[model samples]
Target: MYKTQDIAVVILNWNGIELLKQFLPKVLEHSGDAHIYVADNASTDDSVNFVSKNFSTVKIIQNSQNGGYAEGYNDALQVVDEPLLCLLNSDIEVTENWLFAIIEAFNSEENTAIIQPKILDFKNKTTFEYAGAAGGFIDKYGYPYCRGRIFDTIEEDKGQYNDIIDIFWASGACFFIKNNVFNQLKGFDASYFAHMEEIDLCWRAFNANYKTKYVGFSTVYHVGGATLSNTSAKKTYLNFRNSLFTLVKNTDSKVFIRTVFRMILDGIAALRFLIQLKPKYFLAILKAHASFYKNLATIISARKEFPKRGNYAETDSIVWSYFIKKRTKF
Candidate 1:
């Protein structure tokens, strides 16, 4: 059985010194015996010095450069020998006893390789965070939505999703996975850089016959979009482009058809952005498609590296279900 000390909660930091100062103490106090680490992504700020000076017990792993989220954790985690690895965000405030439920699930569910805790918004407290509200699920087109969140509609937490369940993907905001599985999967695709990379890793895990779960008993409050704001066009570009990368690389069969259909839906979304007068977002979509085409060959070759599996999506179309049917709540 796995114990609390076997878990390593590693927060990926990119110059968020204030976040560390505010939240790290709570983590150190609440986490029983689990090892704590601050994986610095070569920040130019005084974050390392701040952690070193005040948080002596918290270990720091400095990377050579700021490789964003994907490569940053991939590098820092190389030396992390803990049995279970929790890839936490710096802007998250973890609740008391958050590691207990996760460790219990890992001990009980031998086949489960990855897990996510219930993530609420720090600002609102009662509202589900946009990143990974309860757990994550994707449509057939690879559009991700959570049980408590669909598109832009977010639900208030009322103990509705406070149960352990199988999930399609866990949020990167507070993702937990087995170290062996992470190494076997070769970590997140560095090409993703950030955004939707967790989905890609979970999809790869699912294809390999490993289970990804959500332990609702464990909870954390995330200040969503702390590193990159939602309104940023660059975030939009990475999300759109990396999602396509995941679809092409891992979607079971009918890759071409799925890609085309998804792109058509994306075009409609782009048009909607245009109608909304968000020209930057529309152009981001265009740039995303252009980048997709540019890297299609490389992505296609990546498909041969993994064995694809069927029945990857929870629904046929989250877009239709949310927009047309108006089924916002999971």
Candidate 2:
């Protein structure tokens, strides 16, 4: 088993005092050997002070400003010297032996650098969470879906996806990665700010020949969207835009052709939103494309930094599979 000192369970927080109050105790109690840290993102609330006052054993790292998820972890992780880093969200609850399961996987696997445990919904424990159900996989079109979650359909935890396996990406909600791998990649793209950044990081790892895995033996419950709600227009904007940014920066071969097809699919999504009487979502897709175009040069320049990885998608077209073919359960 890996030493507790080698694994630092760092939670990135921003005005989530209530969440910390609710979930931090379990993390402190159940995380037997791993050291815990509260990386406060310059919260105006008493979340930092509360952690400092009550959880005296847990280390606290305060950033000057709230940098969202990507930069927040990038900044806080700089001071951490742990060999293994668990980037846990503030809204998650861990079960007994969760850390042990993750550590065991890393110790047993030779090339595995990133791992995500099965994520169950906190609100409904029986169902898989939306963030990263069993594990994450991307379609040929750069659309991401999970083994237990496709589109809006989330599967119940019937132990179907219980075995450990290779995954295209890991959930940021409770992501674990090696310190060296993270540093070599220079951490998550701060430009992402939040949302889909984990998938982007995992894709970069894939391109570098490192593996991402899902350990179903361990499980954690996530209160999805504690910081940003699922229905927020801002969330919609980030998901759409960051996903495009990910494909541009990481996809192997035929980048231009793949991106063209992606844009067409996005247009169809925008029209669907308009038909659903949600013009904000429609405009959000347009805004995402506009942002993608504006950042084209920078995005294209990122390709030079890393070699083209293998086609990591499990399916060719997730949109067609889900909408046209009606294959919702993954």
Candidate 3:
């Protein structure tokens, strides 16, 4: 058994005591040499106390307040001295030797600064999870989807996408990055609060010439929507709004034109939501656009310090490919 002392498995928690109670044992058991820590996000619940009492060996970093995902990690990681950081979610379950494969890749792939392992669904172990299927890719329009997943469709794990490959983004659910690379990238955009921040960070990394990859051999089962339910209006709002924020901050000179087209596409999507009788979702899109337009100035200012990178998208318009051309499988 190879001992990897450089790795630190840190779980950012905000009142997820049950999830920690359920999954932390496997992480402690299976993780060979990496130290484990729970960065509590000012949870009012008994989560911090529980971990301190039961999991006495697991280190606890009690944050002053809940900063969601982006800022929570940014603050928690300030004291984590490990060279490699595994930002694991509380709702995920790891298999044996998972850390070994990731450590091995980090050792071999010098330029691969960020990596995400094969994330499968905990409910149905054979199927890919919605968060990140077989790595992430964006279309020309800035919409993100995975290899085994296109929009709402998730493919089964038939060992088809079992090869390590470069990705545009890694799922925040089980994200890994070199400590220096993370600090160099300035962590995630705290304004994002949560959803799509990982994509934004990965995009910035790509622009800086750092590669993100998917290691299919190391697998973990994720209970999707443990924090926020998938159908929640807040989730919808964050996805739509943060995606626009990402596009504006990361895209090149064509950002204005893309924003125009994207807004129109979003309108079409809202109409589809209405047709499906999901009024809340339709309203969510509208709210998202309103929020984006309101924060346009701030979002643009956020991009001033960062340089844009071209040739980032793998395909032009995943919406077109999925809807008009009916290309489901990636």
How many clashes would you count in candidate 3?
A: 0
**In what order do the candidates fall by lDDT, top score first?**
1, 2, 3
Expressed as tens digits, the lDDT of each residue in 44-123 for candidate 1 is 99999999999888999999999999999999999999989999999999988999999889889799999999999999
Task: Kindly report which residue pairs in candidate 3 clash with one another.
Answer: none
In order, candidate lDDTs are 0.94, 0.93, 0.92
Encode model 2's per-residue lDDT on 1-330: one tens digit a residue: 466668999999999999999999999999987889999999999988899899889999999999999999999999999999999999999999888778889999779999999999999999999999999999877899999999999999999988999999999999999999999998999999999999999999999999999999999999998999999988999999998999989998877898899989999889999999999999988998899899989988887798777679999999999999999898
Deviating ranges (above 4 Å) for candidate 1 = none
lDDT of 3 by residue, 1-330 (tens): 224778899999999999999999999999977899999999999999999999877999999999999999999999999989999999999999888888877877689899999999999999999999889999767899998999998999999989898999999999999999999989999988999999999999998899999999999999989888999989999999999999999988888998889888999999999999999999999999999989989998988968888899899899999999999999
Kindly provide the TM-score of model 1 when superposed on the true structure, using C-alpha atoms. 0.99
| TM-score of every candidate relative to the true structure | 0.99, 0.99, 0.98
Clashing pairs in 1: none
Candidate 3 TM-score, C-alpha based: 0.98
How are the candidates ranked when ordered by TM-score, highest leading? 1, 2, 3
- Kindly report which residue stretches of model 3 are placed more than 4 angstroms away from their true locations once superposed: 1-3
